[model samples]
Target: MSRGTDPYVAGAMDRRIALAHEWDELVERVRRLGPRFASFLAPPRTQDFLSAVGDGTAVLINVARECHALLVTASGVTAVPLPGLSAAEIADRTERHLTALRRTDLAAQRVHHTQQRARVRKVPATYQAHHAAKIEMAEAQAELDRTLLPQLAWLWDTVAEPVLRALGSPARAGAEAGHRIWWCPTGLLSFLPLHAAGYHDGSGRTVLDRAVSSCVPTLRALARAARAPETEPAETDKLLVVAVQEADGMSPLPQVDEELRLLEDMFGPDRLTVLEGPNATREAVLGQLPQHRWAHFSCHGRQDPLAPSTGGLLLTDGVLGIKELGARAYNGDFAFLSACMTAAGGLSLSDEAITVGAALHYSGFRHVVAALWSIDADTATALTGDVFGSLTRGGRFRPQASAAAVTEAVIRLRNDSPAHPSRWAAFTHIGP
Candidate 1:
């Protein structure tokens, strides 16, 4: 018998068609219930889902027992199998990353102590081990690089390179300015730096090299950011600079003042609402968010390892935790969080992508620049200048160009210190 005339094949086709029709009927019935009911339902059509992607390609990846990447573009959806990745491998690597990160924190502390001690004319007897601390810091940094570099290379070979190949090269795709790629990583993958995935040994085939990478907690989050109304110029064009130079109980960020100065020069005083020191209270910052089109938080950010939601940008009065950030839906364009670990998620809740940076994006900032780990204060200052300089070029607040701007700034930083991934790899853009 011919394949078309086969009973089993015909039965399967009929069942599929019947199920599709029934699904459509059910969808229509739900729609008829009212706008509230309909709002809960996702659009049934493929094009409806594709529309949320905008000009960029959204790669929603699942790294679980079974690993795969669902690439959504304007054209359609395509599945790219991540055969090299495994659940066990991801789990093991994530643990290693956490260990290395902790070591990094210790190293930073030692380095900071050494610097503080050196500043004094006569070193106190209690802090006489400053030289020893410096040596230990260097050793710790070397140890961190060993794990971090290999992880990047692994991600490149297993995940990024294949996905990039499937999407086609930026040159071939006619995206010399860097093709925007929204990384929607799930599970353990959320903990890894997919944006900085690459072989850093002068191989121009890195994720940063090919695409202007931006992260979204989920596809829905990206759509929400896209659908948010733009803040009007009539309301305010002010770039809110919330520089908390020294939050109580935290190490002082001396470069924050310099960052504010550079921002003042790049964007004049009239265009800014400077809230530094005691003025950048949680209430004040939240109040000012609604009035500004853009924001820059030059302060220390804290990440709670056990309770992710407790993580927030360290302000003057208190820490602005993630849960409190959603008090109002903002219409702001962009936010630059030049602080430590603004983008780092909790180890226990690695799948949730719960962080201060994601909270800002959720709160309605279209584009957010954040750090995946602790960043150097000097590097943060320079990077902030580069980012804002790009955003406010020709005296225009162009928030749409933020992702590309961050990419360029990070690339510049990477080029300057090719051997140090810690300096450049931490900063990532989260948005559409």
Candidate 2:
């Protein structure tokens, strides 16, 4: 299983082999008890069951395949299929079946999880090694997805299909934002162009920034046009801020305190309220909603596909996990998330649901706004200031206005110092 000419390849190959060993153990247990006779069959005896199946050694090792298929299908794994055959063949089939299953759904989850975990934190020495191993892992993952997950999906479809289908059925219009903090893991943020957004890595921040500048106005106008007549857009709500930042000391963006104060003054301090952030949970935030329809924030937010534990928003004294977002119920129509990685989600931007915008939309806010990529704080703060300032001047907060305000603000900031054109151009508005 560890056969490889290259050392790096060999190490990765060794990991797969180790996985096989674990699979082998699972199979051996299957052969001893048969598939239908899973330890869960008798009762809560995984302990005694595991011990009883011991000593099969080679024979047990072979059963891993069929056992995998049966257990995966059995749901809750109460029983294993009892094929009318000798123990050795049973073991072999179980092992082989598992090998096949491992080649499918379980494999895909494993691969994605592995890659996601690897990306959780970057390590310099492990960088090259990781990229190289990723190729191998991707191959293995592909083979497993192509081979195993389909079969498992079929099995699930055959068994629990009805219940699952009926359960996720969404209602008309869309799911209500009923006081619950909606969490779409891996939500899309923005579509800004790279150079326009500025990046130290020389990546596509410009392309992404341009996408933001170009799209924000269009989306904002579309939303306004789509109004249901019950609500009209706000002119003082012109701030189309797209901020991506982590919480500092478990608190929302502090640099924006001055800007937020300015907004309170312009939009009316009574019209705005700062809910939970670094120290608050989603549940705490939904306790109250903006009856006035507009709101702003200077907080921390995170979106990571593989690390939900590390994903959350900053209140004041603590971080609110996205997993717990469903607890908060939002009633406001418009909102903003000045947090980091708010829009990052699955590899495909569209499929990602972790952005604050998606959460707001899912919760009930019709004209939710958001950001896509990471942003520069001072620049973002300055742009946001311009936005509120424009809105207070009665300029419509439509998509174009929002976009123009953000862009022009950045332009003005840069014009103030021709040498620093890159500073204020990092923020963009993601309109709904």
Candidate 3:
């Protein structure tokens, strides 16, 4: 019935915006109070410190209160499930987000040479305790959305409108080949890992496949790359194919096979091969990993707390665990993990394990393309096809351009008729 599965997500966002407004007001008020410990103590530092003078006092307390209010309001309302991420997952994301915020604060200090340290006391006092508490609240908020929204699909059914779907965007002209992009597509999932086999086991079939035709054009485009009369993708040590999947489930091999067939049509079936069953073991995947120049998979990939290496996508044989694989060391040509959450790098300050896409990059692949957030399969199908289409249609076979093509398409869709930004902005391009 509701457009958003979790009202808390919107509420949390609105609260954060309101808090930002409050932060500005506090900064303004403090300025009227005159300089901190007044002196000719660097006019700029004084101004900067004054601007954030009460932030230390206000932000933490207010944020904590907001969390408390969320818990209460959520219980009283329509009982809309809150979309939340796990603690570590939340930390990974929020920490990175906060790190940016922290950096912004730090940058101001750079201009004010007199202020050698943080204006927010930088002490581990009760005030700092509250700050930590604030972080916990935000993390919880993220986790709530991460956990609930996926499981409760009906929450957004009415929200999906077809008004903007009719207008297709203009195609970009010319060839721009700078970066390599490896694309992973999710057929359809509702909290199911696209790559993991569990999807097939439990669910009958995804409605997403029929929503749009992703297999034909997307595969043809990549196959065209394989058929390139000139230019070959550089290979350092081996070919890195980053197969993306959800945090848990079976590999998305069967669905990938259909597209693999499409690839064979262009590249010829003999040159193309598909691995299955017990042969899909990690060892087998690894053995094949170093040999192939190009590889593609459809699955789910995750980036979470604890360690980056532990984060991995679901595969046919158990989860294709990344922690054990250690992607940074692999040297490959190009790989695409057509799964959700593959683009995520280390959240916060921590250097996460090779994210689905990053792992390919670190694994020595020249180019990697991954999505930033959980994308709907139907949306992914259309987006991935357009991206590969750009390359197949005479554009440079670079990941950067391909990925940008996707974003541009969504932008075009939005500009033609403003649909939800979340529908398109969810996808992101990663790597050099």
Candidate 4:
């Protein structure tokens, strides 16, 4: 367990050897309680992990602090050099992005409040009533873009580009389709959008162009997802649409009805169930979730940085937190969270991957499409239509092709709004 000539490698091996010894002792104590407990406590074997990821997928584990990114493929793991990356740089970028994001969120809330006021007054929004809020939101959005563009470029220059080149990806452009890469970014890197890292200078030199990206909390999580029971493509039929157009104390998602209509047209009433408005209670949604193979939630989502478990989709009755979803077991194929910040993990718990999307994936939803930040309502609706339309192309719900569908939808969104990175770069696909 401690075989290494280099001093740095030897020290790491030595530490691992000590950990293994400690684990063995712990296992021995747990064995007396139950075999299951002992087995659960056992460390992962190298061969098992290698088999789990398969040949087509590669796992990039960005460890804590300033360190080399570890690329784990079916063959083995290798450290990839990231000369331009540093802990300080990642921390600074994370801070800047989050700061801008908070400002944008506040502005959005103010806009929502103004709309709520006008609705209560039984009057249409006047130019003066809506002008200031809109201006504030626009300013915040511009600042967000200003922070986002540079951070994305930095990530590409420092992390993504170097790793892709090392993986034999073409330096020029045009990466082959269908290749998947699971990014396990820890520490400050977790909050950053690894999937959207690029120059965006019309060079097509981005992670989106290079490969389909996913996020995993840990290798153990990936292993569990890989071991989930597989079903025939045709078996995945039912679609559960949880649409909360207007939740109590939350901004109304005006586009949710249109999104539901589009999905209904695609999936039909026979294979789809829509729980909207007053019907989308937390209990009802949770009860319906197990019966469906695919799920779509079009509602307001909240993320509590201090308490991730408290963060969830704003339903008609209450919040359906991720903790609730993670507690249940499901053999589902896909979940589309067309809500705000479903994939945004807490900054404090950066390495934990505590987000609604992660909860669903770990609970056995193999493929999840979620937002990294608050998304424009119209853009969300349009993207939902486009993504689901692409998924159900031959009159079938294809969950395995989720990443490709997301990529296509995002490209279309980007083409439509070339300057607004916030609208296009918000959504991320996390799965095989």
Best by TM-score: 4
**Each model's Cα RMSD:** 8.1, 22.7, 24.0, 7.0
TM-score of each: 0.87, 0.42, 0.42, 0.88
Which of 2 and 4 is the better model by TM-score?
4
Per-residue lDDT of model 2, residues 371-411, tens digit only: 54344466556666776676457633333244445545555
Order the numbered candidates by TM-score, best leading.
Answer: 4, 1, 2, 3
lDDT scores for all predictions?
0.83, 0.40, 0.39, 0.82
Is candidate 1 or 4 superior in lDDT?
A: 1
Question: lDDT of candidate 2 vs native?
Answer: 0.40
TM-score of 3: 0.42
Candidate 1 lands at a TM-score of: 0.87
Model 3 is weakest, by summed lDDT over 10 consecutive residues, at 56-65
Q: Which portions of model 1 show Cα errors greater than 4 Å? A: 1-37, 41-46, 110-124, 170-175, 229-232
Identify the leading candidate in terms of lDDT: 1
What lDDT is obtained when candidate 1 is compared to the true structure?
Answer: 0.83
Candidate 3's C-alpha runs over 4 A off are: 1-266, 276-279, 324-331, 345-354, 394-418
Clashes of each: 0, 81, 42, 0
Selected candidate, larger TM-score, 3 vs 4: 4
Superposed Cα RMSD, model 4: 7.0
